[model samples]
Target: MKLIVRHAPLFALFVACGDPPSDTGKVVAPDSPSVIVDTPKLAANWPGYYSDTLPCLDCPGLDTQLWIRSDSTFIRLQKRIGLDSIPEGIIGRWHVVNGLMTVGYTGDKPEFYRYTADGLLTVDEMGVADNSKQDWTIEKFADEIGDAIPRMRLIGTFTYWADSQSFQPCGAEFSWPCTGGMDLGEEEGEPIVRFNNADLQKAYKQAVKRSGDPWTVEAICTLGMGPAAEGDGADEYIFIEQLPRTIERCP
Candidate 1:
């Protein structure tokens, strides 16, 4: 079975809250008489970030993590109930229309969201609230708290290749292949970080000193890109340590 490795354990707590019903409003046509004209502007803290466990009919629950960045980028990590698989993460653009947040996903219809002071309410494809599913919400997290944790792209459990002196990052609930191994070279006496999460760095420092195998402690790290391959593409991941950024023991 695939393992479920998360960037930080703190976010696991987001699943405990109860999300209210989605009575915010209904989707309307551009020229409809019922169109919401006085849409509320997004709150300054509305670059919503949340992680929660949602009620599931097929399984025990669905573990999900969501991040809506200031730059209109969105990332969501989701895993099914009772399945021991890496949580798949998707990153793309997000926009707000008529007080509803729309998340763009690849080859899939955009997911609509309604924001409240408490958390984000899930809207179905028909642009209506889905009351059928319980806990259809992700509690908002503070920006500093969210920033303290590494972005979804850089979160995962990894393995070390002693023979080749390489580090292999494995997917926790997703099926991502790390064709290019990770690099640990320092820049200015610190680990080269594209996505800097201060807490994550401390974990790496702790991992490096562990007497046991490296895989026994999961560390936030970056994918290696050769100097000749600079600007080839964005770095796949970055490590940010949170309070509960416990390393996953190798299974």
Candidate 2:
């Protein structure tokens, strides 16, 4: 004998395929409008040299000179006022988010700052303004910070993509296309091809094998302005001078 089976209504199938009902028992559409967030824009006079003398416990004062470049990079020089030591230079990337600027160092905690009328004011990590009257402001000294590009140590992700190499600084949002050659003065006939050094390549390959492609690396490089990767304007590019080693992560 053949058994008869009952089937649900055709509308039930349609209900199963449609969007699930809301908590209020109403069908909610999946194609909802999204809220757009606007990115923070840097001030007109954001890029330049800023200087200030900060108080120090052991020394009379610390003469600090900060260079904020348009390429999302910064160079900070600090010298003890009465000490015989040379100025210490720190190189890293700077980024502004939610109206606060962050200076990210290679292996240190980020410093925060806020834009002021004349310069930048040091702030806490939570973006809170310094309450004491110790004068934590760095006054802008010059509008043009010179055209010379200095060789500095950088920690970033080195990637070879699309048949081209690039370096993304530890805290930067974008990557700069990289070139291999570096000037070796009058002694060398041609520039040293540092990027293709066997040790550097081996480290990069090992990094890729361990943590996938585009691994983090520490290197000494020079930053220069050049044509954008795919645009009509100019952008910052990196010229590798030395590849020190591969870093497990960005600090």
Candidate 3:
């Protein structure tokens, strides 16, 4: 008993100071892993404004009109052409890093775009086309839009992550991935898109009216932007994923 007492304190001290002898290994608590989403750290550029700087004039499908206020804080958008049933006014939070912007909405996960000083803006959620939330009074444009809007063909769609594109015509199609840091095309003249067929127009019109398949429009637009080709309008790109319609040439 004396021997046991003499060593008990030493054993206790060893257990206290030495490596833990539990075979359970590191007890990683089974607590839920926290999700780390990037929240925008507001910058000094309070009340800054960012819209489509490289305006997509007439890309097939989708309709777009996004205006993000600087501080990457608030945004507002509407249909630049045609009308929609989905409510406009997608009020949300935003983050801007360098020229990139991440917009976090109240009802949905966050998205990305670009903020610029030169009035040139770009956004993610692009596949081929896409929407905005605001006070859209389609009833007002009812006279001119007509039932055609419900089934407009030329207005097919796509949802693309639009960036400043230095588009190069690969084999047959124009591949718009270049290293020019969001080139707003030629910022000299107006940009425009001329529909070459009826199906294209109809598919697009349907999207503008329905905001669904066959023309899930994810359109883009800009202000002082132009096309690589000669034109009298603004530059445009079809954000495809967000849209269902396509300009797939008929067989």
Clashes of each: 10, 0, 64
Q: Which candidate wins on lDDT? A: 2
On TM-score, the leading prediction is: 2
Evaluation by lDDT, superior candidate among 2 and 3: 2
Candidate 2 structure quality by residue, lDDT tens digits, 53-114: 97687998888878898977787767788983446545677878777787866457788888
Tell me the whole-model lDDT of each prediction, alpha carbons only.
0.51, 0.70, 0.32
lDDT of 3 by residue, 8-48 (tens): 21212223357785644433434454545565643333243
Give model 1's TM-score versus the native structure.
0.45
TM-score of each: 0.45, 0.54, 0.24
Model 2 CA lDDT for position 76: 75
Q: On lDDT, who's better, 1 or 3?
A: 1
RMSD in order of candidates = 22.1, 20.5, 21.6
In model 2, the runs with Cα more than 4 Å from the true position are 1-44, 52-65, 69-110, 114-118, 125-135, 144-148, 188-203, 210-212, 226-234
